[model samples]
Target: MGYSRDAWGFDEYHPVAQNGSNLYGKDGIGFMIVDSLDVLIIMGLDEEYKTAREWVANVLDFNQNSYVSLFETTIRVLGGLLSAYHLSGEDHMYLTKATDLADRLLGAFNQSESVFPIKFVNLNSTSRRNYDGSCLADIGTLQLEFKYLSHLTGDPKYWNYVEKIMLRIDELEKFDGLARNYVSVSRATFSGALIGLGALGDSYYEYLLKQYLLTNKTEQMYLRMYNEAITGVKKHLLKRTNSSHLFYLGEFYYYNGGKKTRFVPRMEHLTCFAGALFALGSEKIHDSFSEENLIIGKKLTHTCCEMYFTQATGLAPEYVLYNTNSTGDTLYDNGRKHNVLRPETVESLFLLWRVTGDIQYRQVEFLYLLTFKEWGWRIFQSFENYSRFPEGGYTEIVDVDAIPPKRTDNMPTFWLAETLKYLYLLFEDPDNDLLSLDKYVFNTEAHPLPIFVPSEEIRGEGWNRQ
Candidate 1:
């Protein structure tokens, strides 16, 4: 499939057959390619990395009049550049590009009248798109990237803006320490009481734990909030399959002015990240909750893997619904039946493998790859139905259960940046220790940022004291 763009560079390919006609903006390909740069470097493709780096340094322009998703651009492009810089021996050019991109992104948070950052911003102009408000993930996931940028550039503005968002969120009233998924910046209030470790709220909790690690466990607030949130999650969202006894995190929907809560027995492939994150946090803190957190992490990991195994294609769907009333058999929800080639499950597998050193993780990784390749070959044979064969990357599976499971034309940037890269790192060497948990914290997009240490030691151990 044609992955390269003739005009806008590398943007998402909405298959012509799928009524995807417009490129969001010019120069999106540059953003897409950035996601793969670190993967190339990690794989030791020096020549390819050099070629890509030169292209980015020379041809990539951010001054296009394009309205970009603030969250997507920051995580994929800014996060990618910073990760590449660190992994590629602190390349100055990568840092320069990242700074330029971040400066543009800072415009998203420049709204003085608003309490939260706007979701999208026009790169070439000072125009901001208005939406209801940003989600928890959008506002909270910015800490790792922005904080690391501040450390690198000695500009506190980056960290301050993101930290302010976190503080604002912390001030909100939470249901058992869990905030709603949607919030209104204008009203400074949360909209829905329904909560899940899925799309809108997944990274909020993730950043909480990660921000603590990124700050060298110096900030007691982040740790305190994260611990509270996880405690609430286990109490409210954790559930088990009635028949299989498999543990999965379900969504909690509250009604009647928070007096009643309903459990939605559904899980997203995205929530799988929480498993690895829990395990990583437990390993790092070594507190009283460490052992319990590790157990929860392992259980969640197994449930996520079962999401793949139970499917006809041996690949997990985008989302799975469990029967909450009876035996809790997995039920197919048509809306989310497609597998978008997400990496969260594989990402968790990689992390758990590293954290636990269990050979079973490696075995699961092999099975995932096998399923991916089988689907890849099927799509290649039916090239006309999908796209041209031998494209540089893969696309999403429309229906994992279909006989010749349908394929989507669009290939997401994260496929390169996170999914494939995670798989590569998982098999590179179990003992590589390149991204040791004690030293680096991965952002929501799986970009590894080094843990910060203050020049002068602080007085208290903060959350680590326990």
Candidate 2:
């Protein structure tokens, strides 16, 4: 029902082999849809969650061998359902589905190595280690999910395991206190010389520092690491091209002086990272006594809005070339593949709107609503008609213009959770920033904090320390 052949025009090549079982490429598209739910709910959009939850429950199952990427599916769906449970108090049928998925995910945790891969493809098989389990780049994202799991199950292990993973990732990222995309755990070498904050890397840093503050462990090292990552993001990932701030795809440093290349930032990458930073910064306001930290949060929120959103459409490109002057770069002019108006970017916009009473945020959301009503409806109709993303979520590696007329299986659910949650909070309060704070949100790792307020309160009432 989620991605049916009728919803898409699937015929011979990309046939609907198993009738929603193995519809897309190894259930990768399934993961995306699940991720989308997470993002929507977080944004405060309840309807999206209901739709996505129903979609996941009826469409996907973990029993199939083809659904190995279900590890992420486990976290998102379970995490989302738990959030739903939190919202409704009365359990939904979907919560059972989530609990079942959680049991499967716990089984997938490798006690021997203490590492979770991108997914649970094979248990005893080593062949699934494509990036040597480095595929867990954004695995830090599970921070909130893990915390939620611990809260529900009354087991600290879920939160503890995620924290260990964060510390492990922190050690890996500690070269000059900035995180790199790829790391060879076996060889202890950072291979993916490309440095930039795609969703995964960027979110990890946000959680790391934010988690430390939540746990009352915001030491100098934590601050240093967090600041450095932000500095690196601002310095390397951001670029100004003809009055537009473009986030590059990825950067490859030719330390040996070979051809240097940087990819433009994809829509997926920017939307997720921007939201993560906003979430981390928004937590500062809850501290109440820390005006300095609150200011930092305000700045981060402001930057995210400035860099990503536009008046034309809340929707953004799949990717933008960092250096617009260069024509031959792969990062330039990548269009939209999956034409679906991803709800995740809208979630980021809502988060800022909720924090500051900016009427412009509503304008942005209105633009998105208009876009969906106009062009995006076709994408949803196609998704309902067929199974693909109308084209695909990617557009020529970095381009978003080329809509292949089919959606993929990689929807970011955090977008759903974040967006819906923010919207819900906005309607619920519309004023107090206090109510919007995530009580036990994830830090960079899976560490569950009682609260994520600032470490020290800065009383700037009368002036300087001197």
Candidate 3:
């Protein structure tokens, strides 16, 4: 409500600055407002939703000249708008805006000889790559939104556009079914030897299983690819702490472009998404491996919680590096140290709680004995203690381990869209009509999209031609 009144159309709400910024601006897209609009609706903040909806209906426009990230814009704004549309009583205005945005975004695809999407969109409808290569996640995560819009609008072009990209990737050569993080769009091939389920690579796999689930589990192609990817992950990247034997998926530079693996000991906080991935997708992995995947999901989730506890502030850093050979102090905080109030860990806890029927994954207590069961609650308390502003809204911290954690100016929109949304749903009763996992598949940004049985047009032809 405060941000809606104070900085209604900015990319983020800055607490210390007492202002807003269009940091990811494509000519004031109201990045935060658009990204978090569904949050307001889902949380039952009617007054706030009204104000935000007014800004969206009247002020939001996608026809600016500036270039925007294809992945970020799709996941945040397009995904948010679509989720809001479905949740807001099938609001036609939201669908109109979402359609307009998607039409423009379609320009980002097929700029190359390949169907791979480029990283940037010139909102005025100019085609540009902005960069030479796209990451696995960026190209791989766009399916649900596009396909759903196709379902909604009876437009097979969108279904084919995104589906062709997936089919192209499906046909590409991969290392034991694992994809390298980058692709040369012009070359139509993988360009790098690195593989990890973190920032550049996390949600691609998350969506594979989800795409299957998203369409009432009829997409055998998505399921087949997802299973192969998981099998490759276990074969090549799965690792353990030296002493505690905790499971962590480590990165790998595949033998200087060959399949024989060498491990990178770093674990990105972004990589914690694998926890939820494993939890949610485990049962769907192949019959013999299903329970094994579930157990691995639980242990991988515990490793993420352990990362938070290793920090002085009880919040995880951006990443933690492990010294696999070290008999002592296996965890090291290196590179990025800020806690931007990311929701990946609790996102895992929420899904784990839902999938496994475990209260311990959320909030629960035992007599005088504190345990990892308190992770979500402790994380919430830490957010208030460190980042919450005196006036309104919370900011990112420079270092979660800092005593009296130093606050940064910007608070990411995902803090609203993903972090708080997951936290709220973690405690909400699952039987409620709103967002049951069986009914909705959340995009990487945590915007929930309804799962529908795909119509014939969505499964229509010509996309499989690539």
Candidate 4:
């Protein structure tokens, strides 16, 4: 509640500065509070939830004369509100807030001659223009939230806009089903032939399977695309180091306009999400390829976890470079050495444990089957040891590899929304009682939106049924 008193409703909190600021679009909005609402609800922090709920009901506003990221806002703010609506017993306030926000963002879609959304939208501007081009994930990652909004409101506009992205992107250029990073919104064409699954490209593949899973496994197109992308991932981007045989996700770039291709042996913290994606794909897709998915999932997750352990602070850096290094040494770039409280590795560990039912996966600090609480506790202790502010909340480390790691005042919003929530769910009921994978599909932001059958109206639309 210290935050409630000191920095409530602010977009971000800087622990050392003891101040709050808004950077997403506006000042004094619920960017901090709203993004963390579903976390408050599922953890059964009722008192905290009450405070946040009241803020959303009374003070949260989506209307403003400003531009906000389509991907960031959709995944964090819009996705959080939508998830809160479901988690909070179908509260109308959250639904109402989500509707208003979605409407403000809807202008970004369909204005382009393409189905993909523009990079940003002027929230309250009366005049709309074609926005700058979007990254692949930014354009492709809105499906789960927007489709769920369509389901709740009985309005097809949300679904139509997002669904067109899937439909149109399916018809575009791909390397055995993998898409490049740059998406041209105005022209309906991809901007480049560079595929970096570490960041700009991770969620595009994630949403493919999730869209299939979100619609109750009825969307064959998404399944086909997901399988193809994973196959392409294996064929093109998956690499193992000669040093330790650690599996890592690399990048693919086409230099001569699809005539020549090169592989770059680089991975980032963002690439950790692919571990969970592969795990989910392994379980959901019951075929001969399931074994391959499981193998890659485990190995890739091991590599990602290695990032945390190999560092001095037990926290992973932003990214790393791998090679067919003969000496088995992974080169850590000094420039990219900070640990920013990223949740990708933790998220992957949680889902991997859930998928494999291997208690060892939960026990990251030891070889034994340590209790899940022990795992979360040890991980928490590491953060507290290195990043906790004596005043309140936690700060990020400037460099985890540095002895007595340097501290930064900034705490990114995902620390609450994802890092804490995944840690909680890692051990929450271990029996699949809360936010069970069978029942809920998490958006890329880690907000859990329940899976439901599409309405007959939704089911009959085009190849959504096909």
Candidate 5:
């Protein structure tokens, strides 16, 4: 609980009462704080925003030699900076800082032998850590931030690097337009045949739709690929619970040589984003398939809400496995019964409420608040049993099904960046127009970036009739 400069360390899990310094040195807390900067602006906390901005500008340093996750740094630090920069009236300092961070991150994509970027990089050295293969999310989620940076800075390299990833993905052999979860960057070959709208593959589909919107629907390739992916999803991943008839997405591995397909009746909190994303895309396209997409989105949202209602603590688990043969609603234990306070469901709830004007969607806010209160109180009471600790922040739920739900010693950055932020947006008046879907699209991490009108010179290649 003692101090170490201005940085805070990870929550101690084994001891449960002790905290340690940052593994990456003194700026870890600053990086975490930057993730919440947009939340301050969203809540209209001017003084807090100013203070945080000052701290970031003065205290945060990216010159360290620590190795960091490419995906994490881009989405949180770069995405956070870009969102804050746009929201704060295009402050030059934010843009400069964001570009600086992004330039260093560009090292990840510098591999000449591979079509995709490496998984991690050292900020100080511009050296990359190669992984065996990259997931769909890692390959495809960079378009929003990088494209936005290109549009702002007029640097084609940022956009061109990320656009290459999209084009490479389009060339991959897919089963009905569904890409495998992991792809070898150097070989440009898929490692597995499994597919889902969850972790590894979630944002690949996400960026397809978002890239279209970000480019003012001028790019037909994005829309065509997204529609094809949706078709593949409906054909392969769509499933319904036996009792509730609740529609959810599941994962499956397809074997070569006509072998039997293996299906897994599981869903993750991360998959909930598809509901809102689909609904949002429907509103824009307005084609024959739009209504079907909207319907699927609504059903998916309801099923995600049910994940919370079925749990004892009114909180959804990190993942759930369904009983495929049960006549009644039954969830199988997959040894992942804990909730990490993820925001995907609530984020979709907020977006669907905006899209449909449904009071029911807005009403989900009460469940979120109730769950947070119940969990917060229990954790606070448990803290008394441990040694005296610092104030503020909440931890994950070890078991949502527990009577007095057990608590994990970790708190994730998304709890503030996405969970509470989306909940806050849900309660805002409709007239505020803070995050109008027509004007901005959110990155996978829930950071909002303005949708830009495509330049006359901007034209995407590799287009064909659908």
Candidate 6:
């Protein structure tokens, strides 16, 4: 029997304060609140519906900042609000806030030259010493935001801004059709041959293709670009190990190779790339996306399953070894402060399950459930050094050593929203569908329920169904 909505109360699942039991315990109630909203949206959890609403209210209070960073303040927070509104169908005010942020963020765009500067204004001085800071992923992130804005408001300016950014990407593609890992918007040229598709690159390609597909527009140039990007990833970035599984190379061109080169399958980038490919391939289940597409998806999915997923732990590694087609190492990247066991991987597993309904994914999730029970939840690093209660029940952890000894307090909502969304969808009927891209959500208070868009109605000439 299915877990009934009313039986799924969240109070017991709620994190405790300072007793040190799990990551999401008292110190991480914020994440739990967001996760609760995700659960309600996907699974319609009747038990904590009221609590979920209250949780969002709390997040708004905690996240309030006088001067927020672009990625942190604008993209992430706005993304969280949009997601919350989609689930709760309330908080129309969030739309205004998101738009206001978007307006400020747009000023960061170099419309005169059709590109966006990496930093609207660097709040951190680390990069101020040099004019060499850029993030390729933000281009894709901002595009998605603007696309959503246009869809929700029924205005073309939002998408127009995104298109202008696309024009910049088009210019960058001329160098063998590979987008540089970083570029100077002012110079309008690539800095190096370095490239990647897992995080920044993957989403960049996704926006290009998905935008075309969703808008009923297709161009040969886009097809060529997408093909090259995917193919390049397969050649230089992807590798099949002797373990009969595949993993992407951490450093494609080594943005800063040699001594300064850091190459590892960052959990964030890997999961995002894999999830996008899986979802994209699934969306084209009935279309002709080439045998290679399906095979690539299947192979990549299997590889990701093997590389990061440990059925024993149900927790995917933050980084995995991937150097050959025969065998690769499974060493964790513990040196970096950002490398940590994340809840997002679990969410990716849920997404894979939604796409393929594969029993393997469920079994994998079962492992994750066990891992959490055993390892316990440790929330964010505190203000004081690494001093923290390892046994805390916080929902999100900023770093693996988030004890009071290592002290760093930062919480982002993507994990909360994505993880809960995955869990909710996991429990809900697989037959249920998602909302149409054409119809956008307007508020956080409440939004229309996701409606399934029939795959059959979507037709493409010369696209194969088999």
- List residue ranges in candidate 3 displaced over 4 A: 24-26, 127-130, 256-260, 283-286, 359-373, 431-433, 460-466
Model 4 lDDT at residue 291: 74
Q: For model 1, how does the per-residue alpha-carbon lDDT over 371-449 read when each residue is reduced to its tens digit? A: 3233323322332343222444455777767757776767666766787777766766656766787788877777787
- Model 6 scores a TM of 0.64
lDDT of 4 at 459: 49
Provide the overall lDDT of each model, using Cα atoms, as 2-decimal numbers. Answer: 0.74, 0.43, 0.80, 0.82, 0.74, 0.43
Clashes of each: 1, 76, 0, 1, 0, 53
Q: Estimate TM-scores for all models.
A: 0.88, 0.60, 0.93, 0.94, 0.88, 0.64
Query: In terms of lDDT, which candidate is strongest?
Result: 4
**Tens digit per residue, CA lDDT, model 5, 49-112:** 8877887787777777777767778887899999999999998888988988888888787743
Clashing pairs in 3: none
Structural RMSD, model 1: 4.8
Off by over 4 Å in 2: 1-67, 90-100, 111-119, 122-133, 173-175, 185-189, 209-224, 242-272, 275-315, 324-331, 334-340, 359-435, 438-466
Q: On lDDT, who's better, 1 or 4?
A: 4
In the range 278-306, model 2's lDDT, one tens digit per residue, is 44554553444234333333333333333
The TM-score of predicted model 1 comes to: 0.88
- As a whole number from 0 to 100, the lDDT of residue 311 in candidate 1 is 66
Off by over 4 Å in 6: 1-40, 45-67, 85-91, 110-114, 120-132, 174-176, 213-224, 243-250, 254-272, 285-289, 308-314, 323-348, 359-392, 395-412, 434-466
| C-alpha positional error of residue 289 in candidate 5 after TM-score superposition, expressed in Å | 1.9
